[model samples]
Target: MAEKGGIHVDSARELFPRVAEVPFDAEYKFMATFHNMTDEQGKPVVRCCVKGAPDVLIARAGYYWLPGRDPAAVTDENRKLALAENDRMAAAGERVMVVARRDFDPTTFDPKGNLLDLVQDLTLLAMVGIVDPPRAEAKDAIARCHSAGIQVRMITGDHAVTAAAIGHELGIEGQALTGAQFAAIPDEQLKPQLDQIGVVARVTPEDKIRLVTMLQQKDNIVAMTGDGVNDAPALKKADIGVAMGITGTEVSKGAAVMILTDDNFATIVKAVEYGRNIYNNLFNFVRFQMGQLVAYITCYLLAAFFFVLGGVPFAALVILFLNFLISVPVAMALGFDKPTSGLMDKKPRPLKQPLLSTSQWVRIAFLGILMAIATVYLEAIYEEAGVTTAATMGFVAFALLSISRGLSARSETETAFDRDIIHDRNQMFLYSMALLITILATELGFLQRLLGLTSLSGDQWRICIAAAIALLLVDEVIKVFLRSRLHDVKAPVT
Candidate 1:
């Protein structure tokens, strides 16, 4: 049946008839047959004859049928077909030959036309015509890798022209060099030329190893993919080695970190994306942790500074207590927040880039300043009202900072009011921890005295809550503006 771009047969009978089936035990001594047979003198002895499969055949006597053509016209059509097929196989890095049979003598047989010769010739034919095509996903995967700022280079033992054609089909960039090209260069010369070549063709096993080393010299994190025994050494040397589980040699499989079950390049792309996402999330977690540490250090240092100047009032201790108990948990919650839309679009950050960027430092500094200002304002109001009223206000401010920190932990991608953040079981656990710490600190005499003892009146407590809400709103607005202007700087792939 005709299919898109090609033909398909549902059964063998559609192409050739199965007129009879030979019995399993039937004694069969196959003969080496030839068509258009000629002796050493080159004279045709026989034109054509019908027969069963031959035990062996001459290299020049095998015939192939041309689809939609009559068998009687095979002689004329086959010559043209042979030329075309030879060119096709040659382009695909395959050797090609015609196979034919010898004329049989009933009484006298020549040893030169022996079964061994036929077998050897058939072996050569099989070797010449075989070619393995690239996987369907190779092109798309290569393209995606290019888009992601990853370079792909193809190394194959095929002839230079054939390998170059395959590289072109797979979208590999830059020039292809032969194994000889690599071997001729000294290490000194090769080290400087690695960037100019992308496809290495007609390469020996040793050449692949050297090519990998050259890329590494430039500090690239190379990923090697191989399916042969010859590929093991290079595969082992790569940062990430991939092997084809279906067709890979045992040595290659043993050397690789990952195996492609279907030998599909697309699977590798998916794996890379997953790896980047995991790393990105880990980066976010570390950043959030550092923010907490900064907050803790800043609050403690300021409190110490005030104490050294004179005796720190109980109200000041209340502010520090609230900042630590409330802010740190909220920051932890931020670690689990969903990533922004352009998370993967940004290039990977450089390995040498500082963990905290200038923007991040500025944000942390501003947060500390804002928290310090809010504490000072609450303490002043408490002092004006009376000692009892002031103590109550201090307690309220402490509680408010704790809750406000939780609200602020939501990422800039989402608002604090987003139900998802509040409902997260992990966030809930952190919030619970913060609340428990606050209550324990307030109830324990030593802790309460250490932080400056305080109990809140209902009215003063309400004022503190109002103040916390106002501070959080201002903080969120500042974050929104900053995030709007701050473009994501992608990390460089080293």
Candidate 2:
């Protein structure tokens, strides 16, 4: 029996009859070794042998072993044939390994200086090909990445044929380049071809760094994944470094920005989806908060200067209630919104794209102005009754209007009543609760006295609700107009 790193001998045990069990000797522990010999019919026969890469082992072997023939001296033609066989297996996506052995006497053997010399002039024994297929979900994950306008490339240490074969199965497009070929390309020429390289085979750590740098030169946000110490430098250089928690070296994990606990590529795709959703939710939060601030500020300024009110539209306590109890809750709910349908179908946003686009600002401005007009008009109509009554009307209307804007902010282009807004349990529940709280704040006698507010009749409440509904209707019209004209410009929302 033989045992060593990089090869599993137990799987091949069935090839030979089990005469007896033998412990692996530490003396012949090299990848290429001559472990034990047996006497069969008065001739010494080598039992267990060498194991290493086919190309490396074949070069050291001086003779070839075949069935029904004496060991024959290796010729140039024979070496070519053996190497061709290795390539054939690699092209078929199999991991090929070569076995060989050398005759030696254990009593006098001395492994000094370079122990590798012990494998010279060896007899070539056999070649093994093992199939290693990709994970079942890998192809679909890759396809999803492509749909999202993210290009996926495979950088590997396998032979070009092997890498290419695997890349094909994984849905990676473009030609595969060996590391040597990729390195040979001049910097000026390589920059343009980075996108076209689907696979870089037989890559060294340096090659990975160069590829990442070249991609960066083109303004790409590169995400590198690795599990070895040699990959640390490249992983650190990447915009987003991903390490495999299960098999990654400590150095690699330390250098990476993110770790994949399951060591699956599909998880990377899922992360991207989640990241996009968070960004969208943040955008909505900002949009809704900004629109409400614009409405409140614009209403107060217009009412104080133009209308009979001398100062601020609402009292300090009312402002506090509207901001914390109403607006803050809705904004927080918007922050946790789920990813919208067809989110992954859209292209990745450009790095230079602003958080809010021109069209989005225009939409926000329109909504703010419209809400402000409704608030000021209501205040002016009820000013004759009393200042407290007018402020109460404005307060109730503004609060309801802000909550309505939160729902419409769930989407940039879709209607406020889109399924994403109406069916979202979190947003809908919070919106309903906020609405109920607004009504209670007005009707509750203690709240009215504390906040210097007045209760509203059913008709006044209906008017406030109608104002909120009108704001949504106007927002829907703006969304439709933007959607129709957005094709002419850069639509960053998608």
Candidate 3:
């Protein structure tokens, strides 16, 4: 925006394209870029002028540009009109800049000195409105975050009206607070209301850092996003620092933990979804392995206590077949389990929460006992054939039952017969291979000799397979009970 002797030009770049083409000398060309400053005597206006050029100074400010100028040119009616226009543009989610110009003598101008005194009696130029609309997917992303129990906020150096307008459009709820108001309030008062503030306007770098610190003190997980050099401190102080790859300065990028290459808010939502999926996958893997260990230990100890004819429950090679051949492959396959439905609908887990929750522990205990009992029952039924034969029956029964447990581990609440597993072809194929390998190891003549196992008769095989199916059925029943109980239950984060 440009003006000369009361004549206004809307397109400044088009009017002086050649003058704008010169390579920028960053230090002196753009002086007093407004961000978090109150000049001497508490004035908010800032002046910027091109170095080594004509003595024309361009000033940008909010509503404060009405003072220290010619009252005849900027009459009361014009001042009211300008302020109204500024509010109109700001409330429409456009950044409003009040531009005014003043010419000085070039020979007497000092680039390093204060230019606030030189802006007196300025010619009121145009009140230009700039629109930097949010990305198309940003609103949807913010909605997703809210559904996931995540709070999003906007901290900008724009006018409070502009920030509030943008916050409302993005579905962020809360009142807007300016930097001056924030500084006036004590931290004790602000902490309780921090969650209720959706936008913070005209904040300095120090104010941003303080805001992050306040949120962290309340156990809130703060993810700060920025693209400026002044944002480095706050970015580093945040729990997750997101940098705009397209427009971010090098300092901001270096301070951030994650960089948005596309500079889209939707990407952050997708990242959260994938991150939760990975965390769930890890939890399931650990639970699967631990539950299998409990099953094996309980079975061994029960056998040793009930039947005394054995030096060992199973041979050394047989132990290897149970773990490496059957358990490890299925455990690894559990890592590929997709996120369960409504994964993001749950609240975030607490920072101090344990890896295994209490509910998870209870489920593991119940399922592990059921599996052990099934394996021991098979051994008891076949014991008269001798300890070796009983051991062989127990090994095969344990391996098959363990595979069923792996299937159930794919979901915390969903049963084995649920559509979750039925629709996951990759898991089904991998599990089928594990069962096939276990059966081949026992039935093939050379393999049976290598594994130190006795060949099972058709009747014995029937009992073992029935035992495996019984374990699966019982676990599925328990899951049905859990689903009913936990349907409306909220996940505990503390």
Winning model by TM-score: 2
Q: What 10-residue stretch in candidate 3 is worst by lDDT? A: 50-59
Q: Write the per-residue lDDT of candidate 3 for residues 1-494, one digit (tens) a residue.
A: 22744545555434322211122221222222212223445654333322211112222222234355532455566556666777788899988755444444434546556554443455554556789899889999999999999999899877788899999999987979987788787999998888888998877788899999999998888999999888999999999999999999999999999999988889999999999999988888999988988887887787788763362566778878789978987887789887788888878999889999897888787788788877787678677887767777878888888888888787777766777666778887878888888789777889877866677789888888887888788878887888887764655656
Task: Give lDDT tens digits, candidate 1, residues 1-494.
Answer: 12642656454234433222222111221223333344446654432222211221222334433345422323546545555655566467442333333344433434344433332312112113545667888888888787777878888765555667677778886777878887898999887777767777657778888888888877788889999888899999988889999999899999999999988888988887777766655555554455445544554455456541122333466556655666566556655545444444455566568866787667666665555455545655556666544454545564566467556645433356557655568878877777677666656778767765555556665676677788678777877775565534333446
lDDT of each: 0.59, 0.83, 0.75
Show model 1 residue runs off by greater than 4 Å. 1-138, 186-193, 258-263, 307-332, 337-339, 357-363, 380-494
What value of lDDT does candidate 3 attain over all alpha carbons? Answer: 0.75
Q: How does model 2 score by TM-score?
A: 0.87
Could you give candidate 2's per-residue lDDT for residues 38-146 as a string of tens digits? Answer: 5444445434366766776787779988888889999999999999999999989887877776665545555343455556787887888879899999999999999
Question: Which candidate, 2 or 3, would have the higher TM-score against the true structure?
Answer: 2
Model 2 per-residue lDDT at 270:
99
Off by over 4 Å in 3: 1-72, 75-77, 116-120, 308-311, 420-423, 490-494
The per-residue C-alpha lDDT of model 1 at residue 352 equals 66
Count clashing residue pairs in model 1: 15
- Worst lDDT run of 10 residues, candidate 1, spans 20-29
